[model samples]
Target: MKRYQAVRGGTGDLTKPDVNTRVQDNLYLAVNSKWQKDAVIPADRTEIGVNTAIDMRIEKRMMSDLDKMVSDNKVPAIKNLDKAVTLYKIAKDFAKRNKDGAAPIQADLKKLDALKDFAALNQDANELDEVYGLPFGFEVEADMKNTKVHVLEFAGPGTFLPDTTSYKQEDASKLLAILQKQTVKLLTMAGMSEEKAEKYVAAGLKFDQKLAKVVKSTEEWSDYPATYNPYSLSDFLAKIKSFAMRDFLKELLPALPDKVIVMEPRFLDHFEKLINPDNFDEIKGWMVIKFINGLSSSLSQEFREAGFPFSQALSGQGELIPQERHAYYVANGVFDEVLGIYYGKKYFGEEAKADVTDMIKKMINVYEDRIQNNDWLSENTKKKAIVKLRALVLKIGYPEKEKKIYDLLQVDPAKSLYENEKALSKITTKYAIDKLTKPVDRSVWLMPGNMNNACYDPQRNDITFPAGILQAPFYDLHQSRGQNYGGIGATIAHEISHAFDNNGAKFDEFGNMKNWWTDADFKEFNKRTQAAIDIYDGLSYGPSKLNGKQVVAENIADLGGLTCAIQANKVDKGSMKELFENYARSWAQKQRPEAIKTEIAVDVHAPQPTRVNIPSQCQDEFYETFDVKPSDGMWLDPEKRVRIW
Candidate 1:
């Protein structure tokens, strides 16, 4: 049997490589592969490609469920509509009580009405389908079933071709030009003499060159490192204290009446702690440089306050629910039910408990082993990697402690939607302000626990997996291990890889922004990355082209994680062919046209099919598993395959 099974069934002999092949062949034969394949190919009359099948089904299912809810319960058109209206009423009442003037509150009421109208328009699922180009469901169904086979094929053994692109050189030049132009403009706006503006721009460019040099000298940082011990609480406190002080001044210095105060809080907060500030003079100089670089004024307060300590709330918070209950809710979406049967227990039972533990353990072990065995990284860097790896703290389920600010705000049962929005905004801003002057709180999770996603925070050097993503199709106890590992395990690898991607590499083991690579190493890293980007850029999706520069960081992580997961499977004696297929299946999803448009505009990840096809091209294993020749649709020239990590 494959090391990872999708559904619990009979185990296969682990001793033979052909065991996976036999399993896949039998599974394909059992399902009548030819018929399944034919079902996915849409008729000429259909608008969407067969590739869109699963997305369409998900959309249809959601729409049907929503319709039933509205009909049976007469639910509001929008989720939480009643709550929004009530908040607006309360804001208005509060305004009246305080005699602080009701004009602003009345204006908010108008916005609510607009929001309600928008919500009403969106209530029709068919309308949503029209707005978002929907992928066909048949396509997804056809692909998802055979994911294990495809993933293994995708990551099979092969040498990676060295990429020789100088794409970063071009990008660096463009960035330099923009900075030069912006610097001059800012100097002129601040009423500097023409000669001084020119000098300032020249000086800024020179400084940028220095900064780039520092970055270039630290290429080894690009390699993934093992986990480390958590930074001491005292160390975290000291760092935040210094960062807060520097951030505050970065905001205050340029606020003088005669000078242009271009320093925005967001930019300042982002860069203030990132740059070293050992001496007061050096710190002031950095602030001046930022002011000349066109920082906005509106972000000052936000930057200063963002340093708030929230981690203190994490400890001593008693468990919200039993472990079994938490696991059951994650897997089956039932509070105390098994399959269809109800249980007297408050949460999940024994079955769920075992599943969650097993999955988490597998993911962590894979990551630890990969970091230890990585060949591209230096031994010194490996030690630091281990520190970061060991320091990783996983937060599952919901936040142990919820922010208490929401309770202070008043809500009325009746009011317009706009008023409620304003009240909510006020509450959020108040919470932001409350964070100022606090100690660095490591426990504050950037994403809520239930969000259907995972992320790696370079600031804290931690990877997070939310509860919302730990369910069926992604991870399920009932599914075979091959399916679960290929699905959720791939995602876990992706997030772990992010810690070593381009931008994340800027931080050191202690999560401080520091350079720790040799110059020669940095050059090789950039050369390799640019090559990867070029390959991705060549990929076409209809009329649009992939933004190689913008997507380079994420693409690197995708490739690395895919690479690591495949390698881990091999170490465990799993079939490489099954792993590749399962990897592809993990990304199997359909999309609405509206959603596709939105994704193209802002999403960092490639669209579903491209996510599978493009990466597969770089993996030699994929071609071998599918018996793909040079003429195959997904084939790339052997020389063109870029291997960065």
Candidate 2:
């Protein structure tokens, strides 16, 4: 143990400890403190830890390849590669952007200015989508109840504030002050006088504040059924009597659907009332602000500098990100799949994908055993659970065939960045419109392989582990089975467990919104889930308490994931001590105080410290491995432990 600790950087060993302040009450700190203390958060970043390190490693590799592409004199033959290279080169040309200034978005501003009244505004709104700064968000998504068909989804406008809860924070005034300053700066850069800019900024803020009032808290949106308000096109027109809903829909979606799903009807109702001619000036100003802000990063240095302080106010970032790194981000966003295909071919090998596939099968086997052995659930529910587990779709690494939807995408080097953005947006819209009438493609991946994240889609009954997350820290091909199982194995389990979590449990094996639970079984399940929520509800980070109900789905997954990993560990060669330590290492992270503040307001996942420690206390194996006595801070009464998997 001593030799391994020395060789592996001694994360879990507690015999000889380093102390800045004595908070070493649990295994998480004992395992992670030294590293966290020694680590430096970058000047441009709010926080830096395990996940950030892995993301930076991926970024470095991608940037290196992109730089090489830029320097190469040979003309690119592949259409997709050429498109990606063109976008990257455009992003890198800061001199052109500086010269163009706000001219690129001037046409958009002119459209807003030309609106004489609400009638003209509504006409423009119908033609404009969210990317074009429409007052409301509009999109087509598969209906949750009827997963086979897509429906138009309308919701309230997004707030500039990080979360709806931010409006109620003590720092709300300070944050808004920063927002106002930046808005004025951008408007002035767009050729408005200082006096006019201030007036516009005030009007925009008033408009946004009113919209924010009707916006549901992030917690409230968790109840899927609550947000699922479906109405016939005529019913919507009558309900929202203030507006020409039919005409708007006809213009926005030329082939208008008979039915539309209003995610939050109350918000829509308020928006309908707020959009009267009386609110024209404020509404127009707000639209202009939204348009310019969206293009701020792609515009001049003045806009970028103006936006930086507001960003710092939100996330505690001290410096702006380097221009090259910003270009990489833009390039990835513009040509995700093209870059993803290249990234997968260059870095993600077939051997690694196969290894992950094998690991997934083993993890599923463990879940099958648990469901079969569960005494609380009925045989009927147990059978359904096992079926769901077996039927779960696993998408490792990247998609088999990268779609060539962007073949017709034309990015002109002579064009401004905002012009390119508008061009790209139109292409994406056409693609989405094309998909609206088609059957749901279960094989399609929602995220690219180069993004360092994994997710489970309950609508599709599938889990995806992107190639970016399949590498070191998360999974090390050269590391011990203990480490791999503890890291990526737990992540896979987290996603799989989501299929049975509070949210995922609502759907059946085929991704239909049908419950397979009997009344008695469902009652028992809710009791268990509520207990888990209670545990998290009592936990706090900084000045904000966790919205336990909001985060319950994720909390359930975290605990169930740890349980699944522990079972998988039994088949591998490692002590409970080594396994638990590796598990702790997987979640190792630190945050700026401000970042923690925002996370408490917005994030669905529990803070990282809570993620590492809470699940450990619930495990009997953890108590046994660490010899956690009743007096230990990590101790949880066996009866109090909430195990929901």
Name the top TM-score candidate.
2
Query: What is the TM-score of each predicted model, taking all chains together?
Result: 0.51, 0.94
lDDT of 1 by residue, 35-135 (tens): 33334323211223223443344323333433344346543433242232233223223334333322323332232213222223223322222222111
| Best candidate, lDDT | 2
Q: Itemize residue pairs with steric clashes in candidate 2.
A: none
Clashes within 3 Å, all models in order? 70, 0
Cα lDDT, all candidates: 0.42, 0.78
Query: For model 1, what is the error of residue 363's alpha carbon versus the real structure, in angstroms, after optimal superposition?
Result: 3.8
Tens digits of per-residue lDDT, candidate 2, 341-365, equal 6777778998899999999999999
Question: Which stretches of candidate 1 lie above 4 Å from their native place?
Answer: 1-361, 571-575, 591-598, 637-639
**Which stretch of 10 consecutive residues in model 2 shows the poorest summed lDDT?**
1-10
Residue 499 in candidate 1, Cα distance off native in Å: 0.3
Query: Global lDDT for candidate 1?
Result: 0.42
